[model samples]
Target: MKKLACTLIFILLSCHLFAQDETHPFTIRGLIYDEKTNERLEGAVVSSGDNASAMSDKTGFFQLRLDRKAEKLKVKLVGYEEKNLVIDFDDESEVKLIIRLTPEPILLQGVTVTGEHFTEEPVVNSYSIHPGDLSKVPQFIEADAFRAFQALPGVTTAADMSSQISVRGGNYDETLVFLDGIPVYNPYHLVGVFSMFNSDILQNERLYMSNYPVSYGGALSSVLELNSKQGNNERIKGSAALGLASAKIALDGPLWGGNFLISGRRTYFDFLTRMIMGIRFPYYFYDLYSKYVYPLSKNNLLTVSAFYSRDALGLDDDKVFVAQKEIPNWGNLFLNFSDEYFLKEKSSVELKAFMSRASLGVNTQVFFTDYYHQMGTTDTTTVNNYIEDFTARLTFNSHPDGQALAVGLEAKREAIHYDWNIDETDLNGMYIHPLESLFFDFAPSQYSYSGDEFYLNAFVTDKVTISPVSELTAGLRGSYIKNLKTFLLLPSFSFSYNFLPNLQVHLSYGRYFQNTYSLKERKTEAVFTPFMATFFPEDKENIPYSDHYASGLVLSDIFSEKTSLEVEGYFKDRNNLA
Candidate 1:
């Protein structure tokens, strides 16, 4: 009887302990959006306690699983108000939520709506800047978007006369520039003294020094992406500015159940310099930008945009004692159409088609006259180069239980044309008498080349949550070049861990490749008369590539809520550099 009672007690105690150990686990799924604009918010943090958390993806969706012991859930994002909710896993195994966050008002009186604060970003090597920030810095005549980047760490320019940025230790050509969803080639005006981007029309700008997302390619060093305003959909609004060097006008309003934005800028330095300095300066530039956004349905949106820019600089005859003349001109035209569809609450698809054309031309003539007489020799050279690109891309983004996935397919066709001509005539007596040279015969030399290239690329990236404080991102990209008959595979990975609420560590590795190279003179004498000759790929078995290794530590909220510090180190090994 005693042994039977002991066995029964032991069994009951074991059963109770076992029951307590089997705690119920439930999943929380949600979508976050802006309260005012109803636009999806990316990179928002959702946390359940300190050990369970997840970040929203590009589609503004996130999912987290936690045990029944979790009592409260919190959502936090920069430039927005935070929210907390009570969680009850006992009621259901899964809970779905839609969260709306209100934007925080700026304490400064004259400040506009800037993008998210940089210190709150989870990515260690990424930074965002707003147009309003550029206005605080004193520039030449007007604020410049590209010049603001020079104040950041690890960003350098070769000279003060140029606006081309080199991130880390990479060359100017290695950096990729993007406007909206389209690529921009030669994004500089006035020989790199100013960027093609206008500060007044910019909404936000992002810079990735290394470990960029797989959605961006073709560059070996860094990526610079800029976004323009989508226009006010409620009422008509306009702004105009007149600076010492240039003037700009912008207008936006609702039209036919959609919104439209139009802006234009022109430089008057040709007229200003001629009046103020009494110099016959003949240089001017102008650009026009327009965008239209329409809601096709409750779940779909369409966007159309177009941009055009032209630059001209020349010196007419008799401007100098030698009677020299130079006419250099360049221009860019871009058109883009994009469609976005929300397939589900946590999934979406986007399709985009774009075309870009850039052209450069130079015409130079020099006359060498005899000091004693008006007789002389003349030499003339002309160069013309053109590049055109057409691209189509489709991408899908989804948020599953504990991971985010992005898959994309892209196809591009590019055409290149180049032409060069030179003509020279010598009327000097040293070569021949004036009467004999009056009927002299000379033949000009000419060269021309044309080619077409095709490219196909596919990529997929995944962000996996290891734990509340740890996450991993991995991606693979494959590209095929039809003209070169070559294939390239690139792989990248990054891991981040938060040891404390304000301290984090990150490490990343990536392999990048470039198939096209530009040919231009880099001598100091060519700076004043700069010209881009052509872009071509050499005949070789292997293409140029670079391997990058980077690590960094971030400390947020250092001395104040708005202050942060980041220390990073990177090493790159390159082969077959151009």
Candidate 2:
């Protein structure tokens, strides 16, 4: 019996070896580029005749393993002609080829590339904004993202003159804005006419109405995140536009084996009014944006971005009595650095360092002249508020088979300063205090506050595929505030089930916390003078938290080929109102 068993094992081993010899491991690796421009193309599909396929990454690199029986490979990309190459295998197991595809005019007209598809399940209460669609909407002066958002459901603007929007009954200040993975406290120019983001430099925008992921914190209402363009690596390109209120120019080109983009926008209405008419338009706004991208290697990338925007209004008239000079300005500045390293087995690590400052203030001087036209009794009033944030974060993400995990550590420090000295009620016949007109039953006086707070946060999230038609996501976050000497844990959960091929239901719950609270006297929210809740002793137990419960139903491909319907109900319980 022992001899018979040994003979069977030897026969099975010989058969396995013979099968291995019949099929050799074959792999193809290459980069895809444009034939005319020599620019790298991302999202191109490469496939072998035997059904093996791979997609090009952002860097236009792809790798595919195919069966030995496969003879030829084909590449297809939108707006480009299909390319075919014959296989010429040598003794080596791997083959490298640089492929180039020619651009072709699409036969179909009015074929827009909207990212939304009815067949795929999406996050609850989330919307993706295509940068190209912004131009289709009517523009007040130029394309404004915030203005475009007003047409979306659950979003409402304050007025036609203002671009500020409220989401689902939440205050405008409750919304958190991010640019290039960094937080932006103030993302407006001229208080609301135009957003700080330049449409020419924007690549993508996403809005999360509610029940957002724990990866983003310190917000109770919504999140708006924007990503900038990566620039052209092959050749130099520039564009300029003239508008009624503003003028903008953008330039992008290859630099130092990488790419760079720079853009600037300034309202020329001040100059036009002065040049055409002899009137002095003292109010104008300008903003500048720049970014640089470099690839350290095939799997590593480095990026740096900076943004600045300012709105300045100056008035000085010595020709009239009671000569007065007033200057009111506000703006935001931020610098961000990010490094991403891709690992094996569909994993990556991201490290980010960011610095940002938001400042708003006004300085006014009034002079009383004597009967002889001699200047006397000069009074000066100043009000200034600034918030500076320094942050460093490291995040790791892995997707293995049917599950995904994300863990991150973030350290943030914020320094807030407020100063004001006002002796009178009016400045050049206008309200001096920013909120004096909004709040009916309030009085403004000397007030000052200066302090700093440090926060350490750790978060972990897991997404698991329960079955072919269901998914579950759960997350936990822990935060420690040094000034408050407190530690808190927050948990979130989400579940989605496909009732049918075209219908889906999603349920989610989350607990959110906010350390920064606006200081206002009336029911209305103030745009400036934000204070940390930790500064007040009474806020120890009332750290300003909210519990969110939401459920949504999605119907895809029900009405039309490219149409979808979504319905959602949500409830929010908020505490510790400032």
Highest lDDT: give the candidate number: 2
lDDT of 2 at 331: 83
Q: Which pairs, if any, clash in model 2?
A: none
Name the 10 consecutive residues with the lowest summed lDDT in model 2. 528-537
1-578, model 1: which lDDT tens digit per residue? 23433543453344334333324357677768767655456778898885678777544667675665567889987778898988766667778788888887545344343333454556757787753566775575678877777777889886876778888888767788889868887777776778877787776678888777878887878888888876756677789999876899999878899778899989987778789998767679888999898879856778999999888866444422333344667878899999988654245678999999878776666565565647466756576777788999988766554567777778899888877665534412222222111111121246677888888877777788798789999987777788787777789999999999888899999888764554432432333222343355755454667888999888887665556678889988877765
Q: Against the true structure, what is each candidate's TM-score?
A: 0.78, 0.82
| Per-residue lDDT over 522-575 for candidate 2, one digit per residue giving the tens place of the 0 to 100 score | 333433222211133234586878888889888887555456788999888888
For each of the candidates, the C-alpha root-mean-square deviation to the true structure, in angstroms, is 12.1, 9.0
Candidate 1 ranges beyond 4 A from true positions: 1-77, 80-117, 273-280, 317-327, 362-376, 422-447, 528-534, 540-542
Query: Where does candidate 2 stray beyond 4 Å?
Result: 1-121, 317-326, 368-379, 431-443, 520-538
lDDT for predicted candidate 2 compared with the true structure: 0.72
